[model samples]
Target chain A: MSWVVENLDLIGRLTVEHLRQSALPIVLGLLLSIPAGWFAFRFRLTRGVVLTAVGLLYTIPSLALFALLPPLLGISFLSEVNLIVALTIYAVAIMTRFVADALSSVEPSVRQAADAVGYGTWRRFWQVDLPLAGPVVLAGLRVTAVSTISLCTVGILIGIDNLGYLFTNGYQRQIIPEILAGVVAVVVIALLVDWLLVLAGRALMPWTRKGA
Target chain B: MDLFADAIAWIFSPEAQSGSLPLSEAIWTHLAFTFVSVLIAAAVAVPAGWLVGHTGRGREAAVALSGAARAVPSFGLVLLLVLVFGVTHKVGASTTAFVLLAIPPILAGAYSGVEAVERRVVDGARAVGMTSRQVLGKVEIPLGLPLLIGGLRSATLQVVATVTLAGYVGSWGLGFYIVQGIQIRDFAQILGAALVIVVLAVVLDLLFALLERAVVPHGVAARRSAD
Candidate 1:
């Protein structure tokens, strides 16, 4: 408890860094994945190939991806760019699949209805399909949020600062209180972000609240 | 060419491939961690899922919890456990984190599986005066088996990734090779070890795919695609 108080400022800064690492990738992933997912949907031949590649990418351990990215991308191993780039790739990998799944889940009748109303392709997508895809896409975004936050902490192992640093620092010094604080701090950040996403999801899709 | 040659050389090296703690040992250790934690998680998660699905209780909370569980950084959790307990039970302590990671997916899969079972089937069983146990065993279990196993598939993937992370806590696994390679700047070992993890995860998912098929009853298997 005392440790948490003394190091409160450091923990706060780390959490903010963690949020930046997570938030930027999720935003980037959302932007890229929408188009990528639509391309996969529109081009059936590419669907199997694209999804398989994404699955393979996701299967590679986060640690390995971090270790490999610097060499592959010709960046400094210790640079923050390596961590962000690897995490962004991860964000893209899962979000693309989620986008595909969300779009696929939209019923054929909904598409037919849009056509019946004389909705054009792009306009129909934004007005009809995109809105309908909200619940699922939001769910995926929530997952992306949670995962990126967790993965951010992994950077500490490779030498970046985040709440994960608390664990490493505490472990090195055998300070149980600081280690406990790190665990609590990380979980609190995770839950806090999760609730915020939930609120955003509900606000965007007021339809979901109809039942409630 | 060096990476290729080094990879090839490392793959065929007898010492690296066979020892008390060789590549095979590392793979085995990784599998052991994944399997043990998953087995324990299933025991805990499946029952909780069953109760929730059966009674329509706590479903919302379960979903929330699973999301929270996913958000807990496996890497940090393992390190904290080791810090608190030292390395006396590295495998056991690491398993705690893996178990936490495994439970949520399995729970969700199972709950959804049970929840997905057409209510009429359950209603019919109840109308016939069957015990709740009978309905669950004869109807729910068979029908929900696919998703329950699907949960296991999700859990297995998580555990595989997590067991690799667990290596940082002195738990022996394929991750040790990756960690050692990272420490020594041995790219070949890192590549080889990373390859093992990827292959293992893919193979396990494929195996679960088959198991998902075989575990369903013939009647449900026919309707599987329809569902």
Candidate 2:
């Protein structure tokens, strides 16, 4: 308890850095994923190969990817670049599949109606296809956000500063209170992010709310 | 051509052979450590998940807790555990990390499965005066089994990656090879260890897929295509 009170500022700063590290990759990944997913949807084989590669990338341990980066890019903040690349690879794969599934779930008649109305492909995609797929896309985004938060913990192991550093430092010093503070801080951040995503999901797709 | 032959020759040479026992033995120990933790975690997670899904009480809290657990790195958690429980404790960090790993998937699977059970099927069961337990046992569990197993498969792979972290804490495992390979700059050993992890994860996922088919009614997996 005294540890928590004494180092409140440090802990707060750690949490903020952690959030910043996670936030950029997640937003950028999602933004990049949406269009790539849509493009892949139109080109089926390309989608399969890209997604499979991404899935394989997901299995590689984060530390290995970080370590491998130094040889290729001379390390530094470039390590974070590799981390984001690896994470984005995962996000794009998941979102691609999600987008495909959601699009398929859209009834055939809806597509027919869009065609009948003479809407061009791009306009129909933005207006009809995406809106119909909102719920699923939102769910995929939730998973991506959660995974990004989890993977950010690896940042500490690679000498990057984040809340995970607290865990490592506390453990090194055998200080239980400091370790608990880190764990609690991470848990709070995860929960808050999860709730925020859920609320955003609800706001975006009011239709899903009606059923539940 | 000579370089390739020399590399192969060295790989099968006497020194490598002498070092084989400790390396293979370490791998076996790591496997044991991982599987034991996974088994314990699965046992705890599965029951907790079923109960949470069955009763909606504290469902949000369970989800929140699982999310939080999933967010922290198992390696980091292991380090903390070693500090609190002492390094020699078998029930220390590895077990906690695996348990933490297991909770999220089981909870996600059980809750989503229960939630996804068709309303009509549930209503029909209730209309027949079926008890809640009967509805769950007879209808919901069977329906949810495939997706639940899918989640378990993913969680298992996660546990395997985590087991490699045990080396840092002085526990024996495949991580021994990975860390050693790094220290010695032996890319071949590093690749060998990583390949083992990949193969094991793929095999486990395939096995779970088969188990899902065997346990669930036929066509259920086909129906849950995205899962």
Candidate 3:
């Protein structure tokens, strides 16, 4: 308990850093997956190839990806960018499939109705397809957010710092409370972010509130 | 490019193949850890999942538990368990963590696989005088095999990746190279070991994909392709 109290400032700083690291990759992944997923969905020819390739990206272990990225990207071994880039890749790998599935889940009849009402391709997608797919996409985003936050901790092993520092430091010092603090902080952050995402989903998609 | 070449060269170098723990030994240890943890996880999870799915009870609990499981960082879990179990019992500690890490996916796969079977199909089996035991064994298990394999695939991949972290707690595996390399700043060793882990994961993933395909019921496969 004293360990946590004395180290509150350090914990707070690492928590913020962790959140910063997670937020970028998640937003980038969400942005990138939209187009990548749309391409796979819109082009039947590319669906198999794109999804397979993205799935392959996920097969690479997180540690391996962290180690390999430096050499592949010509970056410094300890560069924070490597972590961010790797996390983004993973986020994209996960969310693209969800986005693709979500887009496909939109009712064809609803799409036809939008088209019959003279909605152009661009407007129709914005006003119809994206809105309908929002729930699933948001669900995907929640998964990505939680996983990315968890994954960001792995960055500490490669010299990039975050809440993971506590795990390593606590282990070396055999400070059980410190280790517990790290675990609790991480789960709390994940659940908190997940809850916020759910609230945001509710706010943005009022029609989805019917069941609840 | 030169660094990658060096890593490739390092992987093939005599030093990598002839140490207290050779690359080959590390690979084997890594595989052993993955197999044992996954095997144990399946043993516990499959039965529980079957019960939940068959009885149509505790599904919400299962889903919530898996969701919570997914959020717990494997690295932290490994370290914490090592502390709880003591350093001398690192093997047990890490194995327990891996098993816990694996159960969620396998459980989800097992239960969901059975749950996914058409309700009418199960009813027909019952109507035809099949016992509950017979329905589960002959019907749900066979039909859910593909999804069960899928869950096992994810669980195996997760355990394999996590087994690397076991090295941080002084356990031997392919991750030893990565952890040691990082401490010593040996980029070549780190990259080489990482490549081996990647290859292992990819190979395992492909093998599981094949298993999933082979296990898909003929009717299910036909329906899928027809869709």
Give the number of the best model, judged by lDDT. Answer: 3
Q: What are the per-candidate TM-scores when only chain A is compared?
A: 0.94, 0.89, 0.97
TM-score of chain B of each: 0.92, 0.83, 0.96
Lowest-sum lDDT 10-residue window in model 2 chain A: A69-78
Tell how far residue A37 is off in model 2, in angstroms. Answer: 3.1
Q: Write the per-residue lDDT of candidate 3 for residues A31-67, one digit (tens) a residue.
A: 9999999988888888998899998999998889988
User: lDDT tens digits, residues B1-227, model 1?
Assistant: 45646754775678577854688778888888889999999999999998888888998999888878877888878877776667686766788888888999999998898899998889999999999989988888778999999999989988888788777767379777767776787777766666667778888988998898898888766886789
TM-score of 2: 0.81
Rank by lDDT (best first) = 3, 1, 2
Best by DockQ: 3
* lDDT value, residue A134 of candidate 3: 95
- Which residue pairs does candidate 2 place in steric collision? none
Listed per model in order, the count of residue pairs whose N, CA or C atoms clash below 3 Å is: 0, 0, 0
True contacts kept of each: 0.51, 0.34, 0.76
Query: What CAPRI grade goes to candidate 3?
Result: high
**Model 2 lDDT per residue over B45-139, tens place:** 76677767777777898777665666675766777777777766845656777767766876787776776788898899999999999998988
TM-score of chain A of 3: 0.97
lDDT of 1 by residue, A36-118 (tens): 88877778888988887777687777776775676567786666787888788888888888889888888889999999989
Task: Residues B1-227, candidate 3: write the lDDT tens digits.
Answer: 88888899989999999976788989999999999999999999999998888888999999999898878999999999999999889999999999999999999999999999999999999999999999999999999888899999999999998998778887399888989998888989999999999999999999999999999889888999999
Clashes by residue pair, model 3: none
Candidate of highest TM-score:
3
